[model samples]
Target chain A: MTEAQEKNIPDVSSDFEPKIVAFCCHYCSYAAADLAGSMRLDYPTNIKILKIPCTGKVDVLYLLRAFEDGADGVIVAGCEEGTCHFINGNIKAKKKVKYTKKILDDIGLGGDRLEMYNLSAAMGQKFADLAKEMTERIKKLGPSPVNSGA
Target chain B: MIVGEQKPIEEISKMIAEYKTVLVMGCNTCIAVCHAGGEKEVGILASALRIKNKVEGREQNIEEASMERQCEREFVDELADKIKEADCVLSLACGVGPQTIVEFYPDTIVLPGINTTFYGMPKEQGFFVEFCGGCGNCVLDMTAGICPIVRCSKSMLNGPCGGSQEGRCEVNKDIDCGWQLIHDRLKAQGKLDFMDEILPPKDWSPARHGGPRKMVREDLKIDEKPEDEIEGITKEGEK
Candidate 1:
């Protein structure tokens, strides 16, 4: 495996730290991430979490802005399917993610850089695992095209 | 209300190429309600045009302004000073506004920044459906208030034509069959018998067939003053 790929693995020591923006729904994913921290679970500190009232509140424009502002990758963490506290908020988030993926692909950013993950508030460990997984995935993809110049 | 959308960015950019100073005009009437040519849209379009022009390395002086109603002569007349400063005007209003600008400023180049669609009503937050043809005839009483002329795929007065299948139009599966909706609505209201009456061939002359139509009211007429007499008149007297 390449040095970059090896650096991406969870718990593996390396100097590389991917800048990730996690848009967590307040009802579920935000609480889960907090729980993971309280549980003393070790996860990459590279991710910056932005808590929103609902996942549906994350607009496509926000996703594009994140990338434009030098986020290597973006992960929208919402409530598990059919479990959104705000009714169909998570479903709407999923639709926005799908739409944003298409737009990212069109703009030559590679849609895989953005992802939508669902987890209940109780799944604290899973949230950490997702963070590790996405960070490593983004590490392998290298810095975002927008950030490459800087 | 008239529904319209802004012309493509490239097209608008090309139209304003020759002019060093351009005014982006918006209409705050029907197009505004439909969320097409409103003040907000004017700002968005202006920003986009400015950015696109800058990116293309062709810098032009562009200004933004909007009026309450562009189709009215009085409202358009208010833009005399702004129009005088601008070499060209890019009207964000529907077709009528651009024509009105042309009528007012014969020497100024009037360009349309929007493609006028049709008279429509807001179906939902962001969706507008064409609902009127401006046929100069009122047939809503007979059609249960549904305008088949505008909503129907074929504009058939007596329809649910052979192409209608499963309550949808054959041309577009997404479109609900206008006749099917009309029939169901009329049946629910116990007015299905009205369908049996054949609609007469609509008179096209009242709409577009005849030369331009006009409505004149003698009561609304203002007596023209002789040039010598008007020299003594003030702004208050004109009203």
Candidate 2:
């Protein structure tokens, strides 16, 4: 497969440190990420966390803006379904992620660059795992064409 | 309101590729109301373009500004200084706004950031339904306020054609049959009798068919010269 074709999966190599923007919900994902930090889980350090009131607040425009602002990959970390503190915030975020994925695919950025993850605030290990997984995945994808040549 | 949608980012990026400096212009009127082109959209497009250009290592300098209205020459005049600094403009307004910009600054290339959709009204937030064709004829009186010319997928004035089933159009089950709506509305208002008035075919001359449309209201005209002209006249008088 061509480099572009093969770049869709996680490539855990030493030379890649993908820039990731994680839009974490305050009630769950943010706490989980914090817990992960306290636990000393050694995840990739490329993930930048932006805490939001709820996952539903992650608008599609914001996701696109993240990519536009040089983020190689984006993750909307919300509460697990049915466990959301804000009723349906996670569900709404899931829908937005799906919509954004379609948009990304259509725009030649590839849909896999954007992802949605769900975890409870106590699931610190999951948060760390997610961070590492996303970082590796994006590293495999190579630099976003939007940031590659630069 | 005229509803429009922004063109895809890739398409917009390609359109402005030749220019090193670009002004992303947004209209705050109809396009804004429709969530197509507005201050928010301008910022979004500007950021997208900047990132895309940066990724390509093209060194494009893009800036964003929004105007109250792009369709009017007076409103567009505010862009003079900003436009002068850019090699091209990416207009996020409806088709009318871009044309207005072109009229004022003939030398600059004005690119359309959005696809001009249709003359429509918002059905609800984020959704719009075409309601008028600007046909220059008032047929809504007979059809009970719903415009078949625009609402009907076929633009059939005397329709509900063979494609209408139950009360919906065959083209899309989601769409209500235009004539069905008209019939129901008229029936409820006791104006069903008007449907038999045998309305004649519409005259299209007043629309685009008759060379662009214009409105000259002698009553609204002021005898005094415009402000710009008055300023020039004052300078001449002082000299």
lDDT of each: 0.81, 0.84
- Clashing residue pairs in candidate 1 (N, C-alpha, C atoms within 3 angstroms): none
TM-score of each: 0.64, 0.85
**What lDDT does candidate 1 reach at residue A90?**
87
In terms of lDDT, the poorest run of 10 residues in model 1 chain B is B230-239
Candidate 2, residues B125-188, lDDT tens digits: the string is: 7779888888777677778899988778887777668999999999999989998999899899
Where model 2 places Cα greater than 4 Å from the true spot, the runs are A1-12, A38-42, A82-87, A102-109, A144-150, B170-174, B223-239
Candidate 1 residues B1-239, lDDT tens each? 89998777667878899888898999999888976687877765665555445435565777888999999868877877787799999999999998877765677788998899998888897798888988787688888888888778998888879999999999999999988888888999999998998898877788867877766565765866654464344322232
Evaluated on chain B only, what is the TM-score of candidate 1? Answer: 0.89
Residue-wise lDDT of candidate 1 within A26-133, one digit each (tens)? 999999999999998988888899999999999776776677577889999999988888889989889889976875665456689899999999988999999999
Listed for each candidate, the true contacts retained, as a fraction, are: 0.00, 0.44
